[model samples]
Target: MGQIERLADLVVRAGVNVQPGQGVVVDSDTAHLEIARAVVEAAYRAGAGWVEVIFTDGPIQRSAVDHATVEELSASRPWALARIAEWRAAGVASIGLVGDPDPHLFDGADPARVAARRHDEVRARRDAMFAGMRWSLVAAPNPGWAKQIFGEPDVDRLWAAVSTAMRLDSADPVAEWQARTATLAARAKQLDALELTAVHYLGEGTDLAVGLPPNARWTGGGLIDHDGIPYLPNLPTEEVFTSPDRRRADGTIRVTRPMVIAGQLITGLRVTFKGGRITEVWADEGGDVIRAQIDADEGARFLGEVSLVDRDSRIAKAGIVFHNTLYDENAGCHVAWGQSFPWSVEGGLAMTPEQRVDLGLNQSGVHTDVVIGGDGITVTGTGPRGTVDIIRDDEWVL
Candidate 1:
């Protein structure tokens, strides 16, 4: 098989681990038809009972934001909500393709309006997966994504970069991923032993303290689905993470990597948190876009996740900015605002909304990751053992 075909097999066997006779869903953009089709075929080969393909159109999505009335944009689509219930009931496995083909599709649109509509759409899918459905999100190489990264539509070069980050060039990529994930998992256990109450990040223009829940447990490598099937939620995964104590994040943090939200690029972003709430949000570009998102709900201002990546991480050492959060966030230490993962804190998966709120677990429907650590950024943990170095200058020392 060719490299792309090999990637398809990995997405099935490793990404989500499609089981025999399982129903699979392939959610993709029209621009990623080639890889999507390959994935569909791979699922069938893996003995998937059926494969359902859903295609999203970027231009159509942009047009809706451009002309739709505020009231219409604000209303949740019943059809979308109904589909989530169906997927959850059927126990379907979903593989959503990432990698925006047209990063500037919503460039001229109103940032607030764009964020609102995108949040509404994402809520349905996120709800489905969080509810019970098994899912994975992987990226595909296309001309538009290639052009955005290399400025020349050189898809081959972009693939090479992605492959290097994914360790796809290995003779047995699946085995390589398995080995890497195991190593990372061992690191997570060591971190959990620290019994950290919080982590402090210090760097130029960055001094932020992110609190962890009382029983927070670090998890990474992969996650267990509702039915006990394990899957890596994000392809090319590298970071081990835990949900934050949403009520305790404070200080200022300067984002080191560029991020895109609702098709807009955010760079040189700096945010300040006071009383666990975002008091300031600024960026050299796309500041309005991020601000609009942070204002989506009360929980959006607080942090949900904090992740650590060492300098030796494949994605970090690749020395190329994929501009895709799936890849960029794995390049260094990062934090996510909104929607705490239930798995991060003990007994969280069984907690109700009120209980979650009381425990300081963020309940926002949004989960936006922002990379904040790179060169000069040092992360130290405050735990039962007192303060200990976790990451020093992008190196995972613990």
Candidate 2:
């Protein structure tokens, strides 16, 4: 097999753990057809009963999302999510490839229509595969993405970076990851034992207080369900994270790095949180969208996640910002302000939104991850006794 084919096989058989005879779903944009084809072949090699490819075209989505009618937004597709759920329930495997070349393709689009269509899709799959789903989110570096990250389209370099980050260069990446997971799990257990009060974040243009829920649990590495079925979420993950209390955070958080928000790249984005809700949002570019989002709805202003990254993060070390989630999110400590992942906690999806909210789970159809770390960043945790440093200079200080 060629390099891409081998990578796809590793992702399907090792990362997602495709079971024999189980159906497989490959989701990607048309720009990623090369990787998608490799995925199909890998799925078949893994003994998948059936393999389905869903190619999403960003330009087409941009047109509809930016110019579609209100009715069009209201009648947005629902069957797609339903089909995914059906496959999940049947123990099918799913591998998603996400990396946008133009992050801001929908920057000036109608936010209401976006939210409307978004809610419909979220509502559809709200209960899909609460358990028994083998899925992994991976990346396929395209020319567009390469151009975004490297100033010019250099796919070879991008692929090299991705492969290195994913440890595909290793002689036995699976075994390497096994050791890494144990280390991360041990760290999570240590942090969880502390029962932290709040995490203090500090950096240039940043000072934020991140509060933890009473039952907040630190999570790292691959996820294993109650049934002991392990699955990776992000193929090149190196962060430990937890869901945060959406109603108790306070202070200012400036986006230390550029991010692709709602399809447009937002730079110099900054926000002030009061009483756990974003009270002010500012950006050098794409500020209007941030304002629109903060004004979108009540839940939009609160936080959903707080993740920590080490200095060893591949994206950060590479010194290239891709402005894509599949890579950027792996670079540093970041947070999401909407739509908490049910998989973030034990029994996350089994509970309804209302039930989840009662347990302090932030629920929304939207999940926006924004980086908040920089060279001078320092993250300290406080508990009943005192404070302890967690990260400094974008490196883990603990």
Candidate 3:
């Protein structure tokens, strides 16, 4: 098999663990037809009963967002999410490919409308999966994504890096990944044992404190299918994570790196969170929109995820800051707001939305990841008892 085919097969079999007679769903753009086809073949090879593909085009969606009506924006599409939810509820498998064909397709569009038009149907699927199901999200590294990272638009180079990052070259990548996951899981367990009260940040123009919930548990790596089939969320991932105390985030967090959010590039973004609400936002570009979204959604103002990626990570070593989540999130320590994964909390999957809200667990349909760690950033942890240094200069500290 060729590199792309081999990688796709591995992702379906090892990363997602598609089961025989189970439904398989793939989400990709037309530009990724080849890879998407490979994924379909791989799912069938794994004995999937059926494979469904969703082709999403960036330009078309951008056109709709830029010109669609208010009714269209708020209109819910239950059918889309229903398919995935039913599949998962029936113990189906899912694999997704995220490779933006037009990184800046909606760069000039109204950010408010762009954010508002998202389908709530998809949110149900996300909720169901987080409630306990099987899924995996990988990237195709298409030319458009490459162009977003490298001005020359080097698709081949990006693919090569992605292949290496995903470990497609290894003779037994599944085994290799298992070993890596065990190692990282050990680190997460160690951190969890520490029972940290807070994560403190100190760096260039950045000083923030992110608190930890008493029930917070350190987590990393992949999840399992409904039938207990295991899978990885991001290929080449090397980070340990946990859900932060959503209501306890305080202080200022300066954006040390640029990020592409909702089809727009946001630079020099600095946000101040007081009592878990975004009180201020400052950015050289695309700041107002970021502020609007956080203000629009209920949990968008609270913290959802706290992650730590070491300098030795594959993405970090590659020296590429891919604007996409598949690569950017693996590049370094980052945090997410809006939606909190139910798997991150104990007995979370069984909790109702209202119960989750009472426990400070957010359930917004949106989940936007933004980088906040880099060179010279020190993260310290402090509770009522004492203080423990967690990260120094962007590296994990024990």
Best by lDDT: 1
Clashing pairs in 2: 103-263, 104-263, 104-264
Q: Estimate each model's TM-score.
A: 0.97, 0.92, 0.94
Per-residue alpha-carbon lDDT of candidate 3 for residues 84-167, written as tens digits (9 for 90 to 100): 668766776667888677767777787777667454765777766775667788888678888888887898888888877777
- lDDT by residue for model 1 over 242-333, one digit each (tens)? 98889898999998888778788888999999988999988899999988888887788889899988787898888888889999999988
Q: Model 3: what TM-score?
A: 0.94
- What C-alpha lDDT, on a 0 to 100 scale, does residue 17 get in candidate 2? 75
Model 2, global lDDT: 0.76
Q: Which parts of model 2 have CA positions greater than 4 angstroms off?
A: 74-78, 107-116, 294-297, 343-352
| Model 1 pairs in collision | none
